[model samples]
Target chain A: MAVDHNVFITEESIEGETAGPLAGRTIAVKDNLSTAGVRTTCGSEMLADYVPPYDATAVTRVTDAGATIVGKANMDEFGMGTTTETSAFGPTRNPADPERVPGGSSGGSAAAVAAGEADLALGSDTGGSVRCPAAFCGVVGIKPTYGLVSRYGLVAYANSLEQIGPIANTVEDAATLLDVIAGPDPHDGTTREAGADSDYAAAADGDVDGMTIGVVTELFDGADERVVETVEAAIADLEARGAETVEVSLPSLEYAVQAYYVIAMSEASSNLARFDGVRYGHRGESDGNWNESFAETREAFGAEVKRRILLGTYALSAGYHDAYYAKAQDARAWIKADFDDAFESVDAIASPTMPVLPFELGESLDDPLRMYLADANTTPVNLANLPAISVPAGTADGLPVGLQLVGPAFGEETIVRAASAVEDAL
Target chain B: MSETPESDADTADTAAAAAAAVDAEEVRHVAELARVNLADDEVDRFAEEFADILDSFAALDEVPETERDEDLINVMRADEVREGLTQEEALANAAETEDGFFKGPKVS
Candidate 1:
């Protein structure tokens, strides 16, 4: 059914249980997450033919919950790019509009859900991979707190910032998926018990009475006027439903993009080092020289991936480590403090998920800086290690606009309730 | 280490200086360090793009001096034999293998 959208890298059905919480639901698994006996390419040539010996913990949990596996969804190569165009496979066309790109690196997952190819999808958000595509495709995506979901079987992009999240057509379905996949996994030690046994689906009651939401001024500034207006109208609807909105400022947001990139790329450089063309994946011609072969093998990476790895290597190099990497970490700490301070006064903070609307394919490809800067609003939440949800608020110029709600650490239910309220209004 | 800038303008100045630190040679060197083989065109293009990227990171100069949180938590695991992927499963995806081992490029 989703074959026309270029939304899946591998389109095979895996059988599921007869009955469970997700009975009969179809799920699109992001290529970056491992699925046993299924090809897990991460949309890169190095891994184009690699099949995992094991399933990611999320995959196991979802399958056990009676959700049928629809296919391995396409992604930006190793989850590096914002738009899915960087895939070794071709770009996933946005189901909403074929000309405009589906925001990525989880473009296929969001596109699949938006196209009704799958009932739900799994995506990894290192920066805004999950939420960006979710916003662009006008679907609901949740980037759980850093340790809310297990990352054992995920192809590590950024160890500290990434989490496996869900994308679905509605707040409740996404929350239900979260309930199945959330909680502790022994395979992933980073997972804590905070979200263990979560009843997040029940929390999506669409009731926002007496809730105080912090409308982040920084997130709104510099955003497209149409998107801002659409989000503003959504905020008004929330107010009409009895939720209070206060203008809160996180000035550290000004530094979020740079800090997020420096840290994520640095971590990516380290995490991706395991693809040495030795143990698994693609191999280069030895030519009797090991080092030369290794370097040649890595040539399989696309331009964006190579650029990130190089920049990451530079940031962590001896002469520049302190100036780039360390400073970025300091900014991260400041961002965390800002969120901590904000949460002390308000229940949650809100922003437009993406500053602009769905990008026309090739629009931002030539300018990597423009693509990086576009992640301004979503990256702050990841830097702070907070939970965030992007729910389709409305549309601008016939494209989707998402309102992002951020909650404190382990506050999945709070954001779910807030997002469901938006859904109810819609 | 450079001193923290006193103002936004100073931060911009420092960012420019930092961005200027990169060149074609530096891009090539970093590519080597990253095990990526870039062609001449890529080196030229990346040298230019990397500068723009580093310049945008000027915001780092204004980051408050917060102590790095290095409170490490170790997960203690029982050292015991565990049932894991068999040798066949482990090498199932290898590009080349011999004698039940992953075959590597021959040493020069």
Candidate 2:
């Protein structure tokens, strides 16, 4: 099939699929996820013609639960950037405001759900990719606890941080998709053992009374006024519903983005080594030299991808490994420790998912440092291997602001319960 | 190199020299290791970009060294034989494949 250049990569509708559990529903997949017999580009020219023989566990779950696999959505090349502008394909525009970017690199998945092209979409959240876009697009997105969902077929992007999650219009829909995808899978060894007995959808309606929610003091201090106000209002709504709110500090939060980048890029540099243009996808027609062809093919990758790979390689290089990568790992442990200590006091932590609202498409593309800083508030959850949900709190200057609910590692049940109360209040 | 003999008028020259000290060859070597080919122009471009990036990373030098005491376990599971994909299933979507594995141009 000739791929559509728009948000969807394939347009074929599945026939004979009745309105079952998710019947009459259509879902789009982020391009980085493998969809059997479908072109999974990862928004890279290197994989422009690649197709996967097997489906990602999340994609299979979504389809088997009666949702139609609508298409492969675009993303930042290998999920490296904050804006969809980094996509090898042209950027996906925010359905609400065409001139502005749909926040990335799961921008297309979020936009597809927002634009009503799909009832729901699957996106990988490695840092803020899913949630930030969902916030920008006024949708609900969840990054399940690390190992809650199998990563067996999702294209690797910082393996420890990435999770295939759902993007939907409402918290209930997101929960339903989460129920379908979150579980133990032998295929991915890191999947949590506790995933076997938990049904996320059931936990979505669990009681919220007596639940103590902590407000991360650092998230609000220097954030945009409107963003803080919206999240604060969401907290008020939770308080109205019998949830207690308290202030908590995570001093290490200040260093999360820095630590996140070093570790993510370091892993990315190693993970992306598989796409050398020889074994799969587009092999450059070099002058019959194997090494030269590999080089030529990689040269075809976009600038952002190359930049991340280089940064990662440098961080993981010998001599500097202890200083950068290892130190970042230690910082990850400290960040997790901070979250653990706070969770001991509260059932969950709430914060504004991102400090700033969505900006224009090309606004941060040229400034790499500024772009890296955008994931500041959300990266800690990944570092802690915790479950977090970004639900629409309200709008600020007409753009949505996400109120993030974070819980302890494998504490998805508590987080989901708290999020449901917040959802109900909103 | 005699530390380049610093002088008040030589500040800009010193900065330029510091930037130039970030080897273009090293940048290319890193790029090769990452499996991303760099054009000669990109090598020059990235060398400059990486110099600035490394300058920022130099901040880590200020961080007090910490003990290597992390409880990070490899977290491995007991290896067991399990249900697996058939060779036909495994090779089903390869643009090209051979005897139970993906086939490609020979690597030198």
Candidate 3:
């Protein structure tokens, strides 16, 4: 069970005996989730010693279905960074290339599956957290429609934008894991009351024949030439399999990253406010008045976490709310409209999961904008509240590329179908 | 993947304009509102970094406004009592507890 990827923050075995579809499978869970008596560090010093009092709904569901809980995986502190470098424990090295990053904040989950440390893993994607890492590590990751999975025990970063997803070696395995962890939860009111159950495993059997796949031209606009070429070749393989292809555009995509960050940060500012060192978070040494101790505790957050909390606070501040938060909501509505129009003409849309190959460890650490820009292709899915899957498409210069298949809201079946085709062709 | 889109020029212009909107003082103020105290050096660093990030976000300004739908209802189920966590379980993870309650700093 020892994988040198540094994927898990805490590696311990928990037994599960209820026989179900995922029987005998091992699952690596991101540390941000609540697991009773297990340390959920969330890749931050703020909760280094904190253990949850109860299990996350997803964890309970999977363990109830006979999946063993392997360990708590590392992540970007509170899921804020594009690279796992922000982890307070240590950055997870890409199983494919140690010198490069395993895309984050679900970097450890992807690395765990890619390195064979775990049979399947749970990752939460707010923007591109799950898919980006899956792309870099050459695995399949699914970000179900916004409310498809219950977020009851997932620690909040951006409540409206995040969902717990599956990362697995194969699409079938991913679907199996999804079936176990996904369903409506009374604890999380945001979860959809119905339409949560789907036989994703069955959906993976269909061919892409007669399916109209739209290539997202915007996704290719600024990607590396080799990466683009490799993805196009994958598309050509799909064409050879009898699928029709057409070029499509989501012009509002030009503004997705910006809008996503603004809304995410704003929500983060409010969600993170609860971590004041009083109840469960890390408490400070000083025994002074409540305010000073609270301030000292907040100072323990990682740099990226601080950056997001500060920026978010700025955006939601009185004089700026109209210019930033409101505008971002408008942009979100526009992006959703664009997706509705695109779906009218095409069954699904395809894009390169990320613009470039996984970069070096410290390449974009200091340039926050560059890290934010890398999420362009993936963020629109969150804004539009649709289902998307990232399957290993091809390799450019040895690093794996991911082909993203996006379908309409609650259209997991269509995305799973197209992704399975690409997964087989590649 | 590192290539900039055709709108790079416009992005640069927005960055330049937005940079002036955030300063060290603004960063410090926001940090205070969030209940975090930033060291003087952090204030300066965050000020410059946030300006760049905010500039990127300004692209939302180009979004046209749309009419809000009035039919959106707060998705709520019938309010009924359900099985829930006990007080002991809720306070089990607290750093300090007294009289079956989470202990905290004394309020003024």
Candidate 4:
């Protein structure tokens, strides 16, 4: 039997308490997200002993809406890897195949949902973290428009790109979770002011007839044959349902991974700088001065975390600032602009959430480049700050494959509607 | 951005040498800035690994040009001081507190 990776933390059962909206609906939280009084470790030894003082915005919203936090699910240390193998707590195995990895850094959440341990989960999407795992685990995951959900309590990975989103067995369930947590908050300044009142669940059943869908040409060309075949079938299904599929070009799409890594790592380096021994979490045990103690504690962070900090530090380094960091930001603007143009004609863009299915644990664990490339198809949406969802298209060799639908900023309603249609067809 | 030869090398070495360069001292510096502590062996191991991993960053030099007009704007808020947590609530999570302030290990 596959070891259950579900239910990390659960609420004490209250007698006669009818299950809340999420009553009896078990939920798992990604380790990177803060859970008040729970061990939210971000799947790293550095924070193994740390306990958050307050709930993350999503956690508070979900729990308040009657969703129980089963436990902190495993993730890449500080949300860094595409494979959950980087987790200090150990890699979360895919329920489909125990030897294969559950995609990460939201792998645990996806695996929990896949294994039927939880009805739903909350995962942070920073450059496809949520969607990749969902695809690998054959579940539905949504990465809402940037700032759609509050980041006040989310342990920061990349401030501009990361968003708290839902992972569930179906698009409607994911949409339901999004409706509860999507709103403006004083804690997160970047939240969109215009769409604060939108009801995502209500929009799920909206008309898909006559809607224009874009097929990103770049995503399909070099992707795994089986994954592409699955997505192509989804596009065909949409066409049969009266949705028009158009080939839309995002000229700047090629540079997305390059720009995403620079910005994310740069922000991560700065954000993670606050984790030195003095504040919280594990501190180094060295006897030297404050500097040595600080070094010792940091060294304890996983390889992925350290790599990002250094890359970020170097990107922000004085002389190279204009060359690398500034250029990436400019590219980010262009990517956003490309999306704006593409959305002018299309309701949403469809692609395979992941180019390939889940691989065995340790397969890509040592190859960081290969792992980073795993997120290539999904990272562009984050750079454009758009809403996207991964709905299970079909099973390939008994493994789940997700077809991604990406919409313009604040276009959650459209994506949700389209995704719901896709889910129903499957 | 013009690509540098060293940057190309950095991308090629992303998996190996990049992570191998990080050392204990560098980890500590990053930690102090990040506010987390690590044990000594961790520092040494992470330092080497992080260095090897960071080598991929060299590819940033190879990216095409960026728009000069693009600048980051701080999404601003009005300068209004709202009521926040009281002294008691603010100190509630502290390991030690005195006179509504957080108390820490004694400083010389």
Candidate 5:
């Protein structure tokens, strides 16, 4: 195993119950998830040494289910970047190819699973963090239906768009991990009992026979030629196994990336306001007044985080609120309706998990817009608050390309089964 | 669903506001609003970057007008007191605390 993946920001073995479903398994939790007594840095200097006083509902669920938490994994600072290079600690190298980045902000979680450092790992997906990393690292990741899993204790970044999910080497293993962490938490009011009562692991039975998959052309339009070819081949494989695909169009695709960023940044600006250098975040000298100290102390946040916060502030600013944030919300409504209309005739939607291949280290770091554009295919799913999974479809020019399967809201089982079929077929 | 009024100039102005380039002064102001201190050079750089980002966001103008039905429901529980974090636990991570209260920078 490669030892330099920088997959973990903090490594400590915490053993769970003596016997349960995950007794023999190990997990690498993203640093944003609070683990009691464990330092939970969101890869930002602001919270570099901050440890939570209580366990996040997901952490408690996993530990109670008998899983051993191996460590807090590295991530893009505040779940802000797509390439994981924005992590304040350092970038997590893709285990598949050391020079390339593991897609992030769940990069470290996916890298740990890919490098065999853990049996499974937990990652939070907001605008495709979990699936992007899983795609680049040749693993499976599931971004559950928005309210299926509890988000309590998660370091907030775009609260409405993010969810704590699972990353593992296979669809079944990922589903098994999801089964443990997913459920309604009294702590998080958005959580519902939708997929909590179903057997997600059992649903991954490679049962794509008779499943009707919708191929969203909008998702395919801007993808790399090689990636599109590989995903097409995977769909063909599903057809060989008795599944069928139909071309579908979501006209609102062009606005999704814009809408997603506006909403995410706007939410992030508000969410990150909690780290004002008091009550557990990095503290500064007490020389200045409260607001001054806050500005001075907030300098600990890295460049990408600052960028998001500033833009988010601008989006919510008085003169531009109607122009950006409100319009984005309206676009979100349209995108959700389009998805509902598409799902009326299809069981699931298929696309390339990422529009391009794994980026070389420091490639798009200079151009933030390029990085945002790369998320075109995955952002729509988040906008609609749907469940999607990234399964290793095949290699595109010796680089892994993931096929994304998106299902209806609370439709985890269908996506898991379809993802398992893709896994089996490939 | 309410339609975007075709004759409303205020709506047109709203569409144009996001596409305008944010100057360095505005960037610095926004940084202050966000509570992050940035160097002057950083402020200039952010202005240029924000311009590019805001330009991309101009595409939202084309999203068809529709009444959005966001499915939001309140999850209510019985109004009963539950075990909560104790004062000691709450103050455990505070960098400066006295008399069971967190200390902050002076206001004056």
Candidate 6:
């Protein structure tokens, strides 16, 4: 089989021992996840030749469950861009439409599953990375509640806001992958003790009878008309299957994108400091002083990464700290409050996964802010630290539109149940 | 605590001033702090980009402060020792290694 998509940087098939939950399943792990003896570049030239010495927790869990490791998938450079175009290896083409992007930074994981290169794939979601690609590629992906999956072996990028998630061809498959990977690790201190052993596969009954779903108005504002209509029709189909729908307002969502970028970039600035030339990846041949050598070596970073680091440094600077970072924290809290209030009246909130359809390659690369705004609908879910799933709702023209279902913290079961219904509808 | 706040006009002016605050000099300063080298043209490009990006983030100014930070608590683990990467494994990916240690440029 010709693998046309620029999906995998390294390819191998290591089958697990027989008789486990993921027996015989093939999975492609995003390159950011450490694979023992495999080159995990994370789509950055700085680590183009770097190979990890150990496997991440998620990798261990899946392999132990009998899933065959297929390869290391591509991603945005250090998971910085909305499109995989920033990948030093090259952009991953959308399996659905090769001309357009496979929304990133987990685009390769989604494309791998969509193209049948892998039965399921592992991807990380730092502010919609996994879900956005899943939406654009017409697959199912879930960003589990923060701390549900251990981050021990995954390379850090905006650590506080990211979780390793599963991308699969169906809701059940995604949940099954989640079951194999979701748990607490002594190594990753932030992982909680709940939902580690929950049987997520059992939640895919596809029955949303009497379940109340909230339609977020702010998420609908400024969204493409076709995308809104497609999502609305999907909800109506859910309502026809005995689900109640209500219009809910998360007024603070207007500020969520801003808050998400500030917080993510700030955390990224600190987390990425360990990439100095002495420790890992590429080292420059500079004979200058230590500071100059370090700075010169860091020049290998791509444009988007540099922009974010600079912006993050600015936000966390002394005089502007209270004005930018502090305000973002307050906005995050308010958005979380809004979700908490909405969940009381509804089982889960629903919105269009992405505010717009997938654009062509290099279309939004020139203006970074325009690309950031495309994440408005999805960032709120990450900010609130809730579980969410993106399922293919319907099609706009020939492109796929994803309908997202977000639930209360540790509420992956609710999200899976509702998304399963959406899966059936589309 | 009951003192009157700024008027809407004043807030608008303040927002505009804050939006324009990220100039080329600020971009250079931040790049230095981040320890990432950028060329002169790149600094000018980033300064323009920062102006637009930061302006969009100004929406956070209107959001009221909440008590979320109070809810955050550091989770403590038992002081039990666990197996970690060995010396060889830790240094496996390093670019320049000396006798059992990673080497870097000499500090002046």
Candidate 6 achieves a global lDDT of 0.89
Q: Give candidate 3's error at residue B91 in angstroms.
A: 1.9
Candidate 3 per-residue lDDT, tens place, A18-55, comes to 69887899999999988988999999999998888889
Instruction: Give the range of the ten consecutive residues with the poorest summed lDDT in model 3 chain A.
Output: A189-198
True contacts kept of each: 0.70, 0.31, 0.57, 0.20, 0.75, 0.78
How far residue A260's Cα lies from its native spot in candidate 3, in Å, is: 0.3
Q: Which one wins on lDDT?
A: 1
Model 4: per-residue lDDT, tens digit, A71-135?
67888888899878888878788887787888888988888898887788899999999999899
Candidate 2 all-Cα RMSD: 4.7
Best by TM-score: 5
Q: Where is model 4 more than 4 Å wrong at Cα?
A: A6-24, B1-64, B68-108
Q: What lDDT score belongs to each candidate, Candidate 1 first?
A: 0.90, 0.78, 0.86, 0.77, 0.89, 0.89
Q: What is the C-alpha RMSD of each candidate to the true structure, in Å?
A: 3.6, 4.7, 4.5, 4.8, 3.8, 4.1
The estimated TM-scores of all candidates read 0.96, 0.88, 0.94, 0.85, 0.96, 0.96
Interface RMSD of each: 4.1, 6.2, 5.1, 5.9, 2.7, 3.8
Worst 10 residues of 6 chain A by lDDT: A314-323
Model 5 residue runs over 4 Å out of place are: A1-3, B1-12
Where's the lowest-lDDT run of ten residues in candidate 5 chain A? A277-286
True contacts kept of 6: 0.78
Predicted candidate 6 versus true structure: per-residue lDDT over A1-426, tens digit per residue: 564888887887767768799998999999999988888898998999898889999999999999999999989999888889899999989888888999999999999999999999999999999999999999999999998999888999898799999999999999999999998888888888886778998999899999999999999989999999999999999999999999999899999999999999999888878778899988878889988888889899999988888888778876667668889999998999999999999999999999999989889888899999999988998899889999999999889999999999999999999999988887
User: Against the hidden true structure, what lDDT does model 4 obtain?
Assistant: 0.77
lDDT of 4 at B13: 29
Docking class of 6: acceptable
lDDT string for model 5 (A1-426, tens) is 536999999999988997888898999999999998999999998888897889999999888989999999999999999999999889999998999999998999999999999999999999999999999999999999998899999999998899999999999999988888888889999988876666899999998889999999989997899999999999999999889899999998789899999999999999888887768889877489998998998888889999998888888887678888899999998999999999999999999999999999999998999999998888888989999999999998788999999999988999999999999988
- In model 6, the runs with Cα more than 4 Å from the true position are A1-3, B1-16, B69-73
Per-residue CA lDDT of candidate 2, range A1-426, in tens? 132225765555543256556777889889999877778889988788887877888777777778987778878998988877888878888876777778888999998998888899999999888888888888888998888899989999899898888999877788888888888887787886676656676777736878899999987877889999999998998887788889999987776777888889899888887876645777676665666666677787898889888888877765457666766776787788788789788989999988888888788887777787788888888887888888888888888788899888778777778777777776
| Candidate 2 segments exceeding 4 Å error | A1-5, A14-20, A205-207, B1-25, B55-108
Model 5, DockQ value?
0.50
Worst 10 residues of 4 chain A by lDDT: A7-16
